[model samples]
Target: LRIRGGAVEAYDGAGGRRHWTHTRAGRRPLAVRPAPGHAFALWSDGLVTDTARTTGRTVHWHRAVPGLSRWLAAGGPGRAAGVLQALDRAARMLAVVTPQRIAAYRTRDGDLRWVLPAEPGCAFDARRTARTGGALLVAQPCGAGASWTAELVAVDDLGRIVPDRTPLRNGPPGDHARARKVVAGDR
Candidate 1:
């Protein structure tokens, strides 16, 4: 799912457009969670909208905290909740966040499994990383100006944060230039 022209649009496996839901009251969609089998969940204006895969229609809506749209629009950090598949377990789970924590839910029945406290005043965005063996990689951007920093955390399939992974740090200047030269030489 993606937001375009102030509407949230869902697409099919073949890249065909399925359905579009207009944002209510001029609020753009904050985040979209595309689940397996073409079904998806959208977050907008403190609400979670669930869509049916086969029918391309909304099934229901759930109330969440307000101000997520504005927060995300300003790149405040965390990602909108959605379904994540665990390849090892052969199951899909829903991942959502509150202002202070992150939680996981069973997709098959919307069952809550776990919740973890997030860093205060930071946004948690999850993405797949090669370093995590398919677990979700969470990044929190913090600080400002010359003191900017980002913290990295990994969450495994069972909703537990993986320990001991080192947080990323900004390298000295010219690191990118050297890395680019090395990459160019390899080719």
Candidate 2:
């Protein structure tokens, strides 16, 4: 609830949950809703979903994707083996900043559609993506405070990278992303 005059008196649930809940400091929220879905949240920090409200389902250990092993091994055999091992999984995207560490999804239907590698200025805290046509926009956050760099990648039919990396600056709605011919498809 807002200040009628000075003091704060929230509505039903909000008033009872003051101790455990907090709001954004300087910014105003446009909307609020409960979290959704049946699959449980896999994060330790807790993730909220709609449809279900407070919590959802737990991501079982078997479903979890393990990190790369032997990725840091020395010699040609190490790196070669590392890449080969990772490619065995059915993935749609193989985003990587380096060969050893990065996160992307592997589709149930083996399709290496896209890869969003971490950019130069990015701190590797958020998702980085390079796409081809269908939902191929990768938004990379700029430094803290304000600004964002996004690239709308274009992929080929074989799901191989076509390079053509595009550079973008801050823009309006829908156009918050931008890209032009840049890098050649390395994959």
Candidate 3:
């Protein structure tokens, strides 16, 4: 099977005969992943497209946060929610990361699970992101001028910011002692 110009085509390998074609609507797909039961998860911008391999049927899943339409319309942090940063299939969550916030959705049906917002004037560093035991760990760089520090923050599967009991960093104790204090205070 191959996708071209928003169309999915399948040709018989033996005789090179055209088997079927399925046309999809919306922007081009950014990434495609195998889902349960011979289905595929295709994401583009903020839309989730699930296509069946056998029949080539399509289902478009729109990911959105409830009661945040006005905020999103006003150009709030949720405005950039479409840009996907990471996907955790085992956790059954589709994570979207921006400098301002992180949102997770159910990969099966594209339901909004949780949204983690950054502190005021602080931003999350997506480059150093890591996941452990279903938790998404992100480095948030926050502080005043000349005294800035990258603090480690962990978002649990339930979207709560919880302290990680296990050591995420391997550096000296002093390196993360102060960072732990900041993260602990949030709890």
Candidate 4:
């Protein structure tokens, strides 16, 4: 799919035109990223998708945490920094990081599954660091002044944060380095 003039256009394998959806006015889409077998287009106010759009799929814009909305309203940097597919593709989950938090939603229906608080003053690095069992490791940079720290978070197939996992500290911010790099082949 390609976005042009605030619209999403889908093309066939032979490059033939398929269909298109014009994004809602005043909703500036910052990026378009691949989902499991489809794709998602991220807008400043919300998301617009050709592969997945249904009734009752609207996100409650008012429900977003105050800090996040404030950051977005302020046109904070790295607003579109992180977007990824959940390691468990069968779950059809999409993870997106705003300035203050990481949110997971059902890609097919746009149901919010979970939202994890992210480190303040940091941008979530979208790279996934392999898989551990049914969980995936996520990292972000938490810097104070000239010093930097890496905070690690883990989420399961259900999009819930896995607690008790120690945060990686004093590491190179946003490096792909991890304790293990086990690929979760074909669940």
Please name the candidate that would achieve the greatest TM-score relative to the true structure: 4
Tens digits of per-residue lDDT for model 3 on 1-187? Answer: 5555565565566897766665545654433444342233333334444455456655545553333333334553324333344344443456655567777765555656567788776776655677786566877778656243336667754555555443232223354432232144343
lDDT score for residue 58 of model 2: 24
Once superposed on the true structure, which residue ranges of model 1 sit more than 4 Å away at CA? 12-27, 58-70, 73-91, 97-99, 120-131, 141-150, 162-187
Q: Per-residue CA lDDT of candidate 4, range 1-187, in tens?
A: 6567665555565767564454567766555664445556666655434253222133323222334434455666455555444546454556665545677765555656567776566665554344677777766667656343255667753444444443322122353343332333367
Q: For every model shown, what is its TM-score relative to the native structure? A: 0.55, 0.25, 0.50, 0.57
Worst ten-residue run, lDDT, model 3?
Answer: 178-187
Clashes of 1: 1
Minimum summed lDDT over a 10-residue window in model 4 is located at 54-63
Between candidates 1 and 2, which one is better according to TM-score? 1
> Which RMSD values do the candidates have, in order?
12.9, 16.5, 10.8, 10.0
Candidate 2 residue-wise lDDT, 28-75, digit = tens: 222122112211111111111111223212221112223322222232
Better of 2 and 4 by TM-score: 4
lDDT of each: 0.49, 0.28, 0.52, 0.53
Q: How many backbone clashes does candidate 4 have?
A: 0
lDDT of 4: 0.53
Which residue pairs collide in model 4, if any?
A: none
